[model samples]
Target: MTELKQERAIRTRTRIIRAAAEEFDAHGFAGANVASIVERAGMTLGAMYFHFKSKEALAREVMNSQTEVIEPLLHSEGLQRLVDITLVWSYALRDDPLLRAGVRLAVEQGSFGLKDDSSFRRWERAMTECLEAAKKRGELLDEVEPALVAQFLVGACTGTQLDSQLSSGRSDLTERVVRMWRYLLPGIARRGAIAAIDLDPGRGRGA
Candidate 1:
């Protein structure tokens, strides 16, 4: 009975989070309504409150849930892996409401008095790890710094996606990300490794 109850609770929480994500995606943090979220989830207020205490808590949860959709890529490594990660994320931004909501919330969090850069830091760390691997494999330029390149890549991606979102509602995000890599690779990747790196945005779809 306890196990069944726990499972039910998990499902309820997931439903609420999804609904909250949808609402926040459409309405931003200040505009989202808890009543509407409950209605969208088809759950009672008590059920939602049982999982998340307030709208702030729900927003934070939604922001943190962005990474839940990224699955590990198989047989990928080094510079190509980092490129694939960005491409995969670009695709995910178009398909996943949770990620979209999280991204919007992350950008707008400061307006709501929520100061958190953990998401950006997390992406920088992931990119840095891949860059470090690339460095070991001689794929990186001799003068390139993994941490600095990673930070710059994260900022570049963030700005690229935001522009794509503003112009085409992210319809052009993947293409923009491809363009971003095309411009970035020559600066950070070794001359010999440049041709070997795949810039196909679709390369990560199957990965």
Candidate 2:
């Protein structure tokens, strides 16, 4: 394929994945039917497999892609970026089906235990870099371990999500999660880092 053709191919693949994401969200990973996903994408089973080998594989790719988008946004401009990351994640956790599905799938799988996923190594690396930058800048406690901090943050966020999924959204998981994180991270974050979280987008930091 030419460059233009290849780009189009990539876009088409993205569309298929996005469509599959909704299906996965509605049905969970194992329950989501491939033909339904292909049909929703207006593509054939062969075409679906052309981009992803199987539903399990596609779900993994979906989580992996979310990590890519979220990782950069997490490490932008020091503490401000961490706040931005949390805020972005809060809204996304509530509103974005792909993110919700990944959380749900991870929970429903039920065999991973409480240990951090070494399988999500790329995600761990990204968090390590961000946390190390904060530590170097004195935005985090001096003795803090970045890997442990990363795993703690992940658990706090994903655990909330898994709990929410089991009973629907009746318990206000998002609010409770943000509150818990505020307490957990501030203990380790600089004073400035704690205050850096008020980025309200167009309304200024706290207007």
Top candidate on lDDT is 1
TM-score per candidate, in order? 0.87, 0.80
- Return the number of clashes found in candidate 2: 0
Deviating ranges (above 4 Å) for candidate 2: 69-76, 111-122, 167-171, 199-207
Report the lDDT of model 2 for residue 185. Answer: 69
Best by TM-score: 1
lDDT of 2 by residue, 63-103 (tens): 65556545544436555555455556655666577666666
The clash tally of candidate 1 reads 0
lDDT values for all models: 0.87, 0.66
Model 2: lDDT to the true structure:
0.66
Residue 84, candidate 1: how far off, in angstroms? 1.0
